[model samples]
Target chain A: MNQDKMGKGEQSRARLLQAAAVQFAAVGYHRTRVSDIVRQAGLTQAAFYLYFPSKESLYQELMDGFFQKLWELSDAGGKVTPLARHEVRDRMKENLLELFRFFARMPEQTRIVLTGAEEREELHRKLTSIVSANLRKNQEAGHVRPELSVEVAAESMLAVVQRLTVRFLLSGERTAEQLAEDAAALLAKGILQADRTKEE
Target chain B: MNQDKMGKGEQSRARLLQAAAVQFAAVGYHRTRVSDIVRQAGLTQAAFYLYFPSKESLYQELMDGFFQKLWELSDAGGKVTPLARHEVRDRMKENLLELFRFFARMPEQTRIVLTGAEEREELHRKLTSIVSANLRKNQEAGHVRPELSVEVAAESMLAVVQRLTVRFLLSGERTAEQLAEDAAALLAKGILQADRTKEE
Candidate 1:
């Protein structure tokens, strides 16, 4: 949303949301009040209510937007036609890099949503469904192991992504590309050395 | 820990702690009151105080115990001498199964600790350190791949275990052995099909 191009009402609403994100990220959702948000946004209480019915609704909208953005990213990456095992691995790496970049771009919101228990659960559920569907497709294409449970695989992958994103990327300890490379390699071939690959 | 061996004072303390776990797990730590916990245990506030100073201390003790148990499990599993890749995989599976059984046996405490944001963060930190150290030793023993980051690998593995434990084992949708099998397979070989092994 371009501040200069937005209408007056839209501009006010955007300001309010931006302020709320900062406030929520700093003190959390429960401690943040409407008055504080409005004051930070340089808007009146009436103006805040004009854009959002209640503080709860505004917070919900913020979460909804964040989740929606992540869903779109997951869906977009899954749209690639079924590929070979190596190609799938590459695609996973690319997708993970993109995700890490998104987290870096929105560190505060990412931390807020990922650290909150309920919000994290909701995000995980959505990511699992999308990732599970993609894995099923890959399994059908014979890229993934047939015996693997897509549910477990998806959840596990998301868990790894979440952990790495928070500890490595968000904390500035490692680059997204570096984390993505290691994560993709780990998920593709795992931690075992070369010898075990022959047993299968 | 055995109720049959406990004296009167020990029994009272155990009841209070049990009551607190139920209350905290049911309604969360912030909403639960000391009065409610004592009442549920059929004890008075003074009795509760005799064992613990305040609600915060009691909650902290429960969290500490839960984390300590998990740390010990991870540490014990890491004690096996370096072995063949297959043997290591077997050990991983067995360790995961044992961890799952522990979660199943203490479902309430598991849920309480896993669901709480602060508790979950602290537990993740402890588990990651223990697992990371184990991975480092395995790497030194020529088991894990040389290129892999033990930090990433350990955190990823713990994330998968946590996800599977909460989603499948705690929900009773899968047995401990079943989840351990899938988890170990995923962590050992990942989801990729067999052909990619040659690329490495």
Candidate 2:
């Protein structure tokens, strides 16, 4: 993983991706050109072409990289086995913290994805499916309520995650740890207090 | 509200709005032309200009209308008073049902907003603030958990509402009543069953 160990081509490709993410986030996708990317990367147009066919393709690659990392994290929660109350909240906080940290690590890519990814309905649906599957697994393991709609739950969870990422994490109003703790607690027990509104 | 009761100018404006929604949702904003909208409305280009200065303006109006209705519904949730458990869920259901019904009643605007509204960060924040204010009111009223972050909860609630509207309601996969019912129960009690994962 050492930079010195990278092959010339690999290094050039890495430079291109980093440059593209920065330029795209700064100037936006439409304004950021292939020339801007290459100049920023200190490479020629020919070198850029070797790595990507077009500016759009390079942008897509950056987006795919962000989502790919996220997809990997989606599975990092592992099996949601029944756990002590505190342990359950801790596990949720850990998973959410990882997501916020990913955003922190790749701010540029996250910015690009936030602006452009909504149009890609397929991406939204796929992520929802992955989260839904995880919830389904939890349900079967008795960690989640059996009668709950997993699809709805997954979609709702993603909604909350996306909102918090954009509002709190991105804005620096809260740390990844603080945001995760608050979100995990709210999500675990929900907003309701015990038997306060329990049916008559 | 009767179309036959409308005056000539009012009729022309309504026709233009309807035509623009259909065209915008069909071919997207970029590909859709003023001429196409005018033709669909069976009106002259002159009449279209009299109603809207440009295609973009017309599209904005439609989007505004949708969000305006949603903002009204945001207020309609009203003060959260201590109520029977079933009444709490029913109130949530009624509020959510109003939202789904709004989407159902304005499918074209919903489609356009779904595709484009994410770019409007102000709109998202405003809606979240409104929802958060409602949650804050609930917390003050002793219905919601006082420790819960109302801001995060509001953002999460809006997220879930948006997702369900787009996925299940828009696609006709679920009815408004069903969606509202499921969402209410989930929001009220959350997904974790009582004492299942309680601390040792």
Candidate 3:
């Protein structure tokens, strides 16, 4: 109950979480055991239980934390439309850069998030719906293309972001800013030549 | 073996495969046991073993079959560059339609393919590299935009196709042809308005 004890408890919990993340990333969620986490953290089973009741709870906490951070980052960007096309693209690139940087800083967390765990489906659905809603708003405001299916476009865009994060950012092959810029370009103009389309 | 016995063996193997696919789809690959598959097929363990050495082998066979079918469908369309832009779009749409139809007919197989299993990483890598190589060739031929990173474009395109298939085609919300056309349009022109970009 004292301040020092509470601080120690918080430290212990953080250690356990870090250990769990490492183990989960190395051996995967299904194979990772609570014992391994405790051992890696240099804590006893009692200490782990005091913090997380089970390995599943620990994993859930990790996922929840990541999703929370992601939502906050995206929400901080506010509405995406009502700006010029280039301005909107710049905002998208900035938001994605922040997101990729967050993921890149924690490759273990990135792996777990991208692993398609059953628990992640709910979060994925929520994120997709949020994006769909945003796109719908933008379409109504005449910012996005009118012909595009909001739902399909949201899902596809999220998929592209996730895949790029895993392939490039996680591997440290490219910086978050560079990947974000490329992704924004692709999402904005696609892979087709601009002049060629006009000529056609 | 005699022709009659071989024919029966083939029939039994096909039955087991169907049953395994059903069970795996219902309960997922990790939870579905060899016993459950055999029971569903109304066959013996000996028979299942006579065809697939293990459950992993059966799952691998299923994946291989899907990949083979997909490759054949794409290859049948031939090279994409020789055709005009419209023709290329049609070819891409038609190929995607066939692929979507394949997934629609067997949603269970689609679930397995999209589940991101460890065994699937190799197949995914192979598919991405093939797409990247094709994109590189197109860029060289001045068909694709030279500014785009072939690797990133390939991965993003594949991700979009997969997400669309799972969300639309697999769910039966849209016909394969409709989804393919919309997907092709998005892939070709992207999600942005044409004149808006020029104006900006």
Candidate 4:
């Protein structure tokens, strides 16, 4: 049936995207070819164009999907319960750790998304939307300091996590889980040492 | 006459490296070519190979120089004058801003060094050396906590600034100075609402 054919096409498209993500991230965008991506996906070269208009457009989609997923995950079941500060911190930590675990689990995908850049303003704007929207939500919840611009706070936090993960993955010095937990603790603890037993 | 020839060669080599850094960072490592680098430096392709064996090796040198400069500049001079806790935070802020500004001034060089892979393990060892050495200096003067592992702290700080710089540059949003200043404040304050004023 026509409907059955459409379903098969969608499945093929998804598989192609998955394969492309790995190849692009591992070797980079410029180095990868349409034939190579289709070969990895066990599909013909024609299958690629059936899904993506061009390599550039596919890259744009990959990046768009990446940040969109992150935003969804972060925003899902979100906002700390107005519990004790430590409790809120624990919840925040758990959410962040989940994100890192996702990265560690699918590092190839993470690399692809983070390093992937296309010469398109529209895609960058989408990425910015994902980041800025999360910032606004956090601001509304009063989870972050109101004094700081939501944009700065959100972007800065993202920058920290991105670099930290890159170091952990590339350097192989620390476990991803440990880095995520420690980062949360530090960010929650503030800069100056407190009377709390935990050393600042 | 031999000495004059050597001096000219050294100057030619310097020019090539500088040109390569600009092109590599802007166009990325893969996109840059030996021909373009030579042309940019107003020299001959033969002259480029005379100093560097290949583009990759030239990139390696550029990376090495970057790490070496970071080491030389990581010095804190002295601890914050225990007047106000905010003063300590402010001083820390200033240091990060200065460092980020230093990197931003040479964005091309920054990109080449930052956008490399795990094959460069020797470079990691070198960079970590700079970090640990600086921390040890801070510890010796009673500025850094002896209990804290200098390696993690150093890497953590580096990650924050580097990641933030990437976002700042790639997004074309924040001015380099604004990003540097804001990122410094964020790093110094860590990300908590806790009263750092008590440290004063």
Candidate 5:
């Protein structure tokens, strides 16, 4: 039964991934070994070798899955029809809340993603570029401020979300909803006093 | 003379640190070996051991130097007398510009600090806490918006600076002066439009 064997193989791969995520989160990528992953998954070395040729490949797979999900969410956010200037803030806040919720569901994966793995830098670049493009689009639409550099703004926003998610949301300090709301508010209004005169 | 020998020993130590920074920046902390450092420094294993007991200790010294410099700059900024409300933004920009200049002088060290090395996370936490304390002080003085959480704002600001520094400043795409001015503006006015009606 070829189909039956394929199903079993998929289950084995899933188990290995779960174990790898836990190990990588706890001890970090460089310190984690295939043996540790197999032991945690209650699988044999032979099984691991069947699924992943090397620990690096397994780590790549984990990172790939993480980025794939993130891109999917970003795509979904992008497809939302352009909203009124007043409504864009709410939509952006909701999208960010969803993104944080995704991170909350797998904080270990979040840790691995934020660990500055060399391979993942490519993903980071892609994500920032995508955010920059989106910001440029919003700027063209007169939704965002036109003076700021889209590239820098996107990078800054990514940095803000990443830092907050890793430091607060992962630690359970506040719910994703709260963080998203507050972050959105801060990004929307900034930290400066509204009535203050703009000075160089 | 004893003093002559001591000077030679100090010179050897400096050479080793310089070589180690190059190695760590090119490859990463995990892959780098003491042998490579010693060879790069044009020194012997015996000489390396005479100055530092191990590779870990050498790395620790590098990190210590980096953080000490950062703390000094932060302290200098903190000592600046509370400026007029309109002048605070310019002073903050000037302070950040100085910091970016510091990073520019040693991009290798910047890479090391941002590489998320396990030990360096402690330093990152300390930096964030210090920033948070300062934000709270400003908030109390009514210089900053009171609605935002000082802790989150501090973390976000650090994240923005870190990302921009690593991506742009390290690559020579923008000068510290330009980045500081733009980042200060964004943080002051935010990405949102100024005339928008407040909506949740």
Candidate 6:
């Protein structure tokens, strides 16, 4: 595609994703129609198809962006000085803190990712991959337990983070700061991998 | 209600619940209509209202059954002995293993509980109460750390369990026995508790 067309495509797609996130989160995926998203984006209804072929695609894009940002946090930690294996968890904790802080501000994606859309096999599969990769990376760095399976560890830990974030959004009880702090503790202690016990 | 009528009512309700679970798991809460449930249950559609005012009520009843069984497990453990804290967890593990094994065999409620319905406000509230009560019981028994806020501990721990269970359901990778054992270790090690350095 030409650069101009590519740029336009990206812009419209971004607007649709942003609009979808709001509508889907507020009214839910089943309730949010193409017309609603177009109206929210202030774009033509047919134009949404120009960006996303369907609602599920739009949801995938939204999740793609959300996870891309989360993955970036882990990558950003690479710039920090390397600590010993145990000490490296502090860096991971910082990454978790940043991720939780970012999530608190965007409960729309947070809700869907944690609970709503995870029911969809496609979305759940994509999320599983994202989690598995991150866990492997942390394991490779020696910051996480090698004895534990990264795939299970990743899914397990993501479940904890996702659940806590959803509750934060739902109950309106926890502040972003509090969530970040709690997430830090969850990571530092390896809440999912504690005891390095047998996989269950 | 008369005994005969009550017995019939209970039988009808059980069948209704079974039909609802299958439909809800298959099509999801929003998509699964009450007509579909009654049809699946081989009953008149209007009769559903007699048992459940709404489809949501059926779901509520299902959840109530789940919570009641969990408490029963705790009660059984209480009858045995209190001196062996680890035994409580062991029996708890056995209870959960049976529960989750049944869960695995049953169609799919992991998603229904987390993401099936739109908003799931009432469901979350029920879950929160069940979790809160369980945490309080453990604290009173001195099995859980009294210093930690019951609300936070309960919700967080529930989140952890729910997340892992969903992952297990979606991935179909982890064995139930392994999950129960790992959870036992995690609980024993105080991973879900407030602090690691200090005694509970």
Q: Tell me the whole-model lDDT of each prediction, alpha carbons only.
A: 0.79, 0.74, 0.75, 0.65, 0.78, 0.64
Candidate 1 residue-wise lDDT, B1-200, digit = tens = 89999999999998998899889888888889999999999999999999999999998887787777877888754664455554666676788888888888888798887765546776778878888888788777656777888899888888888889889888899998889888888887642224233322
The residue pairs in collision within model 6 are A200-B178, A200-B179
Where is the poorest 10-residue window by lDDT in model 1 chain B? B191-200
Q: List the residue pairs that clash in candidate 1.
A: none
* TM value for model 4: 0.62
Two-way lDDT contest, 2 vs 3, winner: 3
lDDT of 6 by residue, A7-91 (tens): 7767777778888998887777888999999999889977988777889888877777777786675454454334555455556
List model 4 lDDT by residue over A21-72, tens digit each.
8898788888999998999999987878888999889877776766666666
Per-prediction DockQ, in order? Answer: 0.54, 0.48, 0.47, 0.28, 0.45, 0.33
Using TM-score as the measure, which candidate wins?
1
Model 3 residue A61 distance off true place after TM-score fit, in angstroms: 5.9
- The numbered model that scores best in lDDT is 1
DockQ of 6: 0.33
TM-score of chain A of each: 0.79, 0.76, 0.80, 0.63, 0.80, 0.61
Q: List the residue pairs that clash in candidate 3.
A: none
TM-score of every candidate relative to the true structure? 0.80, 0.79, 0.79, 0.62, 0.77, 0.64
TM-score, chain A, candidate 1: 0.79
Model 2 Cα RMSD, 1 decimal: 5.6
Q: Which residue ranges in model 5 land beyond 4 Å of their true spot? A: A1-17, A27-66, A76-81, A116-119, A190-200, B1-17, B28-35, B42-65, B75-81, B116-118, B190-200
lDDT of 3 by residue, A140-192 (tens): 76556777787887888789988998888878888898888778778865421
Task: State how far residue B72 of model 5 sits from its true place (Å).
Answer: 2.6
lDDT of 6 by residue, B1-200 (tens): 34466677777777788888888777787798988988888888778988888888888877666656544543343432343454555565775576556556553455565555653576567666766676676667766555555565556556655666666654586777777665544433442334333432
Per-residue lDDT of model 5, residues A1-200, tens digit only: 34366687888898898899999888788889898999999999999999999998988888787788888766543543376556666777888898999999988888877754744687688888888777777777666676778788888888898889988998899899988987887775542123233321
